[model samples]
Structures are given as C-alpha cells and as structure tokens.
Target: MDEVAAAIADPVRRHILTMLRDESLSAGDIATRFAISRPAVSRHLRVLRESGLVRDELVGRKRIYRLDPGPLAPLAEWLAGLAGGDRWERRLDALETEIYRTRRERRARGPVEHRREHTA
Candidate 1:
C-alpha cells in the first residue's frame, strides 16, 4: 500500500494513469502527451510499473502500458472505511442537543433568588 501511495503521489504519474485507464498506450504515445522528455516519462512509467499500478506488455516492437487497478484495492478499501459511517456525526448531534436543552432549562428558571439577612 505504501508503494502504491508513493507511486500515485506524483501528479504526472496520476495523469498518466488516467490516460491508461480506458486504453493501453505505447511508451512513445504517453511521452507525446507530456511536455517532458521521453526519458523522464519513461522514468515515471518505470516507477509505476515497479509499484504495481501499471503493467506493460511487449506487442511487436512497442511496449504497451495499461492500468492494472489491482494494487489500488487496499487504498480504495481504506477510503471507503473512512466514509462508511455516520455514527460520529450522530454522536456530535446528540451532544449538541443535550447542550441546547441544558441552556434552555437554565433560561426557563430565570434569575436566582437570594435570601437577605436582617440584623438587629
């Protein structure tokens, strides 16, 4: 998971992944999409391949790159867990309701009456 996160941390690599999401592309095809040199894009692809976010196959003379998506499962599960429940929100709402009720009760009681002592 750490390797996957590190691989996806780059905006350029993320964009590369987006490009490969629907279709596979050759290394040259991916390089053409960016302003960077082919070597730079190749380095990014290497990192992605090592991290398991992408897979490449040799087709004829060209190597085609495609999104694997399997390594991202752990990241997706973790994110889903974070967004899974409203229990925290419900607890906060209950606390807020209790605070408001206490304030309302105090206000309804008005001011406190004081006993005055009479001295001879």
Candidate 2:
C-alpha cells in the first residue's frame, strides 16, 4: 500500500497513467507530450514501472508502455474490503456529491469581475 501511495504521489507519473489509461505509448511519444526533460521522463517511467503500475515492451528498439490494471486491482479491492466494503463506497459517494455541489455553486456564481474599486 505504501508503495502504491508513493507511486501515485508524483503528478507527472499520474499524468503518465492517465495517458496510458486506455492505450499504450512509445517512450519518445510520452516524453514529447510533457514539458519535462527526456531523462526526467525516463526516470519517472522507471519509478512507475518499478511500482508495478505500468509495463513496457521493447519493439524494434523502441520501448512502449501500457497501464497494467492488475496490480492496482488489489489496492482497489483492499480499500473496498475495509469495513466490509462500505467505507470506500461511502467515500466515493461523498466525493461525487461534493463534485456535483461544487459544479452547481460554480454555475450559480457565473462569470467573475476583475475590476478593483477606487478608494477615496
């Protein structure tokens, strides 16, 4: 669990996971999408690969990465399994409700005004 948490804590790594959520990407392709240095991207990928959240295959000298949902399944199940599977579900519900409320409030607020009033 600690390993999974640590891996997910990196924002770039999270974005990498997002990129690979439904499709695989080449190493070069992944590097180009982010503003970070290629070496930095490689390092991040290395950490993610080690964390078991991603897998890579070498094809014709180019390495391709894909999300491996298998390892993450255990984490999801563990969270859901806590408190007999109700805790995680309740937390998810709370999050969804909060998101809906926030959207509603934002829509109510409408556009923002940036002018500052002059003080005498």
Candidate 3:
C-alpha cells in the first residue's frame, strides 16, 4: 500500500495520527503528550494534515484536529484485499495499545536506567 508506506514514513507523524484517531486534540495537547518540542509536533501535524489522514479547524484561538478517514478508505480497501486484513488490523491495534501503555508507564519513572540492578 503506497499510502501506508507514505503514512508510516515518519514515526512521529504516525503516532500523531494514531492519537488523533482516538480523539480530536489541539496542537498544544499533542505536543504535551509527546517528548518532542512544540515545533516538532507542529511539523508532524503538518505532515499528517498534508497526507489527508487528519483535518483541523480553528476553534476561536485554538486549532482542533480530527481524524479524516476519507483518505484512508483506499488504504483500507487495499488492505482488505489481503487474506486477513481485518484480523491483522485487530492484532496490530492490540499490540500498539499495549506498547503505548507500557511506554507511558516506564516514562512516568523519569530518565530510565539502561541497566537494572540485579542480584546474582
């Protein structure tokens, strides 16, 4: 899927799209959720917006972002051509959720030590 390949080229943008799919979020909100700077987050948002996976509108002074599934329709249909696209999607979704949750848990602990103290 060329769209999938294009959409997944940048990890940050992919994460931003995933987050927006779950719920509409402002630029600042997305920046807060990511470890990167606000400008970096904005750049990722720009990519998502350009890719047609997300749309944003100015709500007063704030820009609210939402997932635009219309563009992803083709990608979905292409994926459906596979033997188990639906099942594969479900499994991938579960894995992604688990990974995100685990990362949040560990990040909450502050600068993670590469080496854990173990008693021999």
Clashes of each: 0, 0, 0
Residue lDDT tens for model 1, 1-120: 999999999999999999999899999999999999999999999999999999999999999999999999999888768896576778999999999998787677664511121231
What global local distance difference test value does model 2 have? 0.87
| Residue-level error in angstroms, candidate 3, position 58 | 0.6
lDDT of each: 0.92, 0.87, 0.81
Per-model TM-score, in order, reads 0.69, 0.65, 0.61
Error of 2 at 74 (Å): 2.5
lDDT of 2 by residue, 25-45 (tens): 999999999998999999999
Q: Candidates sorted by TM-score, descending order? A: 1, 2, 3
Q: Specify the poorest-scoring 10-residue window by lDDT in model 2.
A: 111-120
Q: Name the Cα RMSD for model 3.
A: 17.9
Q: What lDDT, from 0 to 1, does candidate 1 have?
A: 0.92
Best candidate according to TM-score: 1
* Segments of candidate 3 deviating more than 4 angstroms: 1-4, 82-120
Backbone collision tally, model 2:
0
Which should have the higher TM-score, number 1 or number 2? 1
lDDT of 1 at 73: 99
* Pairs in clash, predicted candidate 2: none
